[model samples]
Target chain A: MTLPILQLRAVGKSYGTVRVLKGVDLDVKRGEIVSLIGPSGSGKTTLLRCINFLEAYDEGEVWIKGQLLGYHSKGRTPQDRDSEAVIAEVRRPVSMVFQQFNLWPHMTVLGNVAAPLVLAKKINKTEAHRLAGLALERVGLAAKVDAYPAQLSGGQQQRVGIARALAIEPEVMLLDEPTSALDPELVEEVLSVIRELAHEGMTMVMVTHEMSFAAKISDHVVFMEAGRIVEAGPPARLFGKSATPRIQQFLKPWLDRSLSI
Target chain B: MNVSPEHIELLWRYINAMLVTLGVSLLAAFIGMAIGFLLNVLRICYPRQLSIPYRLLVWLIRGTPYFSQLMIVYFGLPVIGLTLSATQATVASLALYSSVYFAEIFRSGWNSIAPGHLEAAQAFGINRWQSLRHIEMPQALIFALPLLGNQTVLVIKESAVASVITLPELTMTTGEIVSATYDYVGPYALLILCYWLLAQTIALAVRGCATLLTSPQRTL
Candidate 1:
């Protein structure tokens, strides 16, 4: 078995009295696509944010490429801090695609893709643009290299968002409902690109509402409710035979629709 | 009373001098703004560093009168043996004054961006500097343009105060011409006209730039 590229152990996050994530553990192996399916506000997005240290966790550890992230201890007290030093360390191998397609509106497509290569990776501008052009071409946005975010449709923008993620050559990519903001017709275009990335062996942990897509593409489907995963396994056994009533109830309508279609 | 032909010639000369003064002020403003922008970025990224000393400098320059600041640079520097030309003193004072206000304007503009934007950038492996250069600074500049325009116009007017140090700028030339003729009204009136025209031109340019900045698909 290939070693996992990412792991979250006993992860918990709370904002004041509300516990958003509670002792959740998850892992993503290299070249595997894992789908995180849950109700709204169920900590799916929070977990992704925590992996990249975008949201600091209250407890637990995240390991990326074998490095224990943000686990600092001088005295017995242990400090929970998201310093730039720690964030930069964790962010080196991970990239995220946001739900809103947060492309820098001021930058051209090439600029958006080339910036990280030049600034973070310390590559020259000429080589950065060259690589960025290649990444854009992979996502079929080569023609729109000079275009801005406002010029593109919802699907195209999401593809650009994906291209931006790919330009960095990340080991693990976290996508937080990447297609949620798209129109129904535009949804498949974004999903197909994601599907292509999965086929290319990109390790992805996706937060998705589309159960059918999750079932079809996911190597491991995790069913989350409230703030914890209740069922997780291969799509066939888990979706065909949900042991818990909660899992059954959640999957019933989704299964019926898939069967009808 | 007939406006003297020599006064008309002097008025034209005053215009030329004011143009030079404006150029100096523009350079100073640009330099000050560049430094102030660096400070603003540091303060935003690390709020703890924006200490009382930093705030005091901003407040001191912004609080004190611009003319007094010019006086300090012109006369006080001479007392310390770092004597600058009148034009240099004027540029230094106005630039320092405008930069403090520019820094505050930038700070406010940076605060206005949605946090989601930064999060998205972080997730994309575009580190801190990349995010600011490509994402944050451009957006903040767009929001700060109108205020920057107002500051630019103020810098131009403040160049008149340099005339006190005998800088041969518009106001100084007007004073010299009026004192010689004993008819201060004509030359000073034209000075006021010159300032009004300059301010209006800068204002129009600022509005035009702001329009293009906010327009869709133009930046790319």
Candidate 2:
């Protein structure tokens, strides 16, 4: 019985006056596939961003592998930000895949994947390139290593995005609506790559709308509304006759769409 | 001989003047870009520290005419206990005058990038400096090359303003030669041709560099 790899305690974030996440608590153990599903503006994406300290939650604490993130300690103000070196060390194990693919347009596929390793991990160029090549090959993009992001299709670019994240060898991957920017046909290709990572016991916290995929792959499905987690449990509990009205109501549209398909 | 002695001296003067103009333009362009890029970064990243001062400077510079600015640096600055030579004033004033436009170009370039691009970099523990260097700046530069290139070429033409200070650049040399030799058809026509060719060369060089930047593999 080891501790969870990620722990969120009363995590809250606000943009000036409007609060986006409130008292959100989540625990993700090693190799856990946690899927956050909700309607738009539910703070699920915000929650995912908070986990990586990308948005910098204003209140409470985010614990990655038992080390506090964002502030110096729990229940601290945003002003009590940690030093960059400390923040860097704390979040070193985290990597992200963005909704927009977010591949650096100036870099080729291989260069895009190799940059973070050299930049973040301080790996030598030769070693970083080798690791990046392997990551690309894992995502099945070896043929397009020299191609620029603009030259690749959306699916291939997202795969490169995945490869870049994977190259850093993070303990947990934060995916913010990974397929939301893709065409319907392209979504499956990205999903398949994500699905492969999930099956390989790669720990991931995904913000997704693929209800059937979630139902099939997720160990735990969290239903969020407004700025809080309304309900969360294993897939059977959340998806199968949800006890919470909000969870059922949220899943109803997605369920119907999936069922009809 | 292919050319007469008097004609050779005139040609030599023209070449020297063209060199001065080219030197001033290139130096000013690069210095202005470096200042603009640093100012843009400071304002964006530390708005509280830099915003008001930078805004005041930019407003003052952008609001004034380049000729007056050149005069102020060359003439009026001596009143402020900071005298500068004609060439120094030309380079300094042109650099300052164009810095505002270059800053605006850099600002647009930075904004043109999606937030996700920075976020992706940030999440992987790529610090602010690393993210800007590896991910943000290059893309912003590619976005800004055409506009930045335009401004650089414009500086060549704008250096004509320096002639008023008797800096002996192309335009000043043309005036001097035309007055001495009474040959408007030769030096005047040559002045126009000199500027035309200089601007064209810079514009072509910038386009070639942009193509290389945007598509490096093909160039390789």
The candidate maximizing lDDT is 2
Model 2 per-residue lDDT at A140: 96
Q: Which pairs clash in the backbone of model 2? A: none
Q: After superposing candidate 2 on the true structure, give the runs of residues whose Cα lies further than 4 Å from its correct spot.
A: B1-13, B78-84, B177-187, B212-220
Task: For candidate 1, list the clashing residue pairs, or say none.
Answer: A96-B123
Clashes of 1: 1
Winning candidate number (DockQ): 2
Tens-digit per-residue lDDT, A1-261, candidate 2:
899999998988899899999899999999999999999999999999888777888877799999998777544675688887788899988889988888888888888899888888899988998999999999999998898999998889999999999999999998888888889999999999999999899999999998888888898999998899988899999998887987878778877877899
Which residue ranges in model 1 land beyond 4 Å of their true spot? A72-91, A236-243, A248-261, B1-8, B67-89, B112-114, B124-146, B161-168, B172-189, B200-220
Candidate 1 is graded, for docking, as acceptable
Q: Which consecutive 10 residues in model 2 chain A have the weakest lDDT in total?
A: A70-79
> How many residue pairs clash in each candidate at the backbone level?
1, 0
Which DockQ values do the candidates obtain, in the order shown?
Answer: 0.35, 0.51
TM-score of 1: 0.81
